[model samples]
Target chain A: AQTVTQSQPEMSVQEAETVTLSCTYDTSESDYYLFWYKQPPSRQMILVIRQEAYKQQNATENRFSVNFQKAAKSFSLKISDSQLGDAAMYFCAYRSGGSEKLVFGKGTKLTVNP
Target chain B: NAGVTQTPKFRVLKTGQSMTLLCAQDMNHEYMYWYRQDPGMGLRLIHYSVGEGTTAKGEVPDGYNVSRLKKQNFLLGLESAAPSQTSVYFCASRTSGGPSSYEQYFGPGTRLTVT
Candidate 1:
């Protein structure tokens, strides 16, 4: 079974600063996908970014970027120029290339201090 | 577009009671999923449907039942609710195959409590 682990239970970052959330996964398959989802107080889950295992270049979306190290099985999300609206619960998820199911980590609560 | 929506934004029930959560998507997606979100547990899949008539159990399917009679709707039912079953439920949908297939759009979530 594939499992995702997010070590940081909570994180805090000042507005306009940068913060990184760590995530690691255990998987035997070579072809897979990684994603980061954010849940705000409204309880709406939003997709932040995603990285394909076969893509050596990490995925970046505006202020959000992922550092994906396949060999280390690490995928960390970096949020730059953080804003108050960025405060939320962030989750790391994994999905195998051939599978439709997604395995998720516990989550990290991100607090953006303004 | 409405994306995905779950009915009964909040509900409370007594032990042994029964209820159903309705999920509807307007994106014409072929894949629909049901998941439960608990504190410190993120979200776990309960059941998923590949198409209109096919349903499959997910990581945490116990104590839950699902039906997909229509292509745009997926229903999750709890025959006998338990206190442990109290959690925020979410519905998601995505295209079966496409460049955006990996993306699963989520609903606002339904908060349920079983006393």
Candidate 2:
């Protein structure tokens, strides 16, 4: 079974500052996908960013980017110039390259202070 | 369009009570999934359907049964609920083919508490 680990249970960052959330996974598959999802108080899961394991280049989406170290089995999300609206529960997820099922991490609660 | 919707947003059940949660998607997606979310534990897949009338067991399927009689509807049943089963359940769907296959649209979720 594949397992995703998010060591940080909770994290906080000042407004306009940057914060990094760490994630690591255990998977034997050579090709896979990594994703970051955000869930606000409304409990709606929203996609943040995604990285393809086969791609050596990291994935970036506007202010959200991922540092994916495939060799280390680590995929971390970095929020640049964070805003209050960025506060939410962040989850790291993995999917087998062609498989549709996703394996998610425990989640990290992020608080953006004004 | 309501991408996906789950009925009985909140439910409370006794240990031996049986109930079913309904999930409907308007996107005509081929893949539908049921997941349970608990504190300190990430969302875990309970069951999923690849297409109409085809269901498959996921990571956690014990004590849970699902049926997909129609393409747009998926039902999850618990014949005998237990306190340990208390958690928030989410329903999601995605396109079968297309670049969007990996992107899952989720419902508002149903909070189920079994006493």
Candidate 3:
């Protein structure tokens, strides 16, 4: 079975600063997909960014980016110039490159201070 | 599009009680999923449907059942609710092709409490 882990239970950062959330997964598959999802107070799960294990280049979406180390099974999300709106519960997810099911890690609660 | 929406945003049930959670999507997505979120745990897939009339079990499918009768609707049912089953439920829809299949649009979850 594949599992994802988020070591940080909670994290806080000042507004306009940068913060990185840690994530690691256990998978034997050579190819898979990784994703970062944010759940705001509204309880809506929004996709932040995603990375493919076969790709060597990291994925970036505006202020949100990911540092994916395929060999280490690490997929970390880095939020740049964080704002109050960035406060949310962030989750790291894994999926087989050819499968539709996604497995997620225990989430990290992020707080952005003004 | 209204995106993905779950009916009965808040529901309370007694032990052994039965209920069904309805999920509807405006997008003509081929994949729909039902997931549960608990404290300290990220969303866990309960059941999913690849297309109309086809359902598959996810990581946790012990106490739940699901159906996808139409292309845009997926239903989750609890035959006997338990306290441990109390959690926020989310419905998501995704396209089932190429690179875009990884992106899932989630609904504002439904909070269910089983006492």
| Model 1 vs. true fold: TM | 0.99
Best by lDDT: 1
Ten residues in sequence with the least summed lDDT for candidate 1 chain A: A95-104
Q: What tens-digit string does per-residue lDDT give for candidate 3 at B1-115?
A: 8999999899999999999999999989999999999987898999999999999999899999999989999999999999999999999999978767779999999999999
TM-score of each: 0.99, 0.97, 0.97
Q: What docking grade does candidate 3 earn? A: high
Better by DockQ, candidate 2 or 1: 1
User: What tens-digit string does per-residue lDDT give for candidate 3 at A1-114?
Assistant: 899999999999999999999999999998898999999999999999999888999999999989998889999999999999999999999999777779999999999999
Given candidate 3, what's the lDDT at residue A68? 90
Per-candidate Cα lDDT values, in order, are 0.96, 0.94, 0.94
Q: Give interface RMSD (Å), model 1.
A: 0.7
CAPRI quality band, candidate 2:
medium
RMSD of each: 0.7, 1.0, 1.0
The runs of at least 3 residues in candidate 1 whose Cα sits more than 4 Å from the true structure, single-residue gaps closed, are none
iRMSD values, candidates in order: 0.7, 0.9, 0.7
lDDT per residue for candidate 1 within A26-79, as digits (tens), equals: 999999999999999999999999999999999999999999999999999999
Report the CA-based lDDT of candidate 3 relative to the real structure. Answer: 0.94
Report clashes for each candidate as comma-separated counts.
Answer: 0, 0, 0
The superposed Cα distance between candidate 1 and the true structure at residue B88, in angstroms, equals 0.5
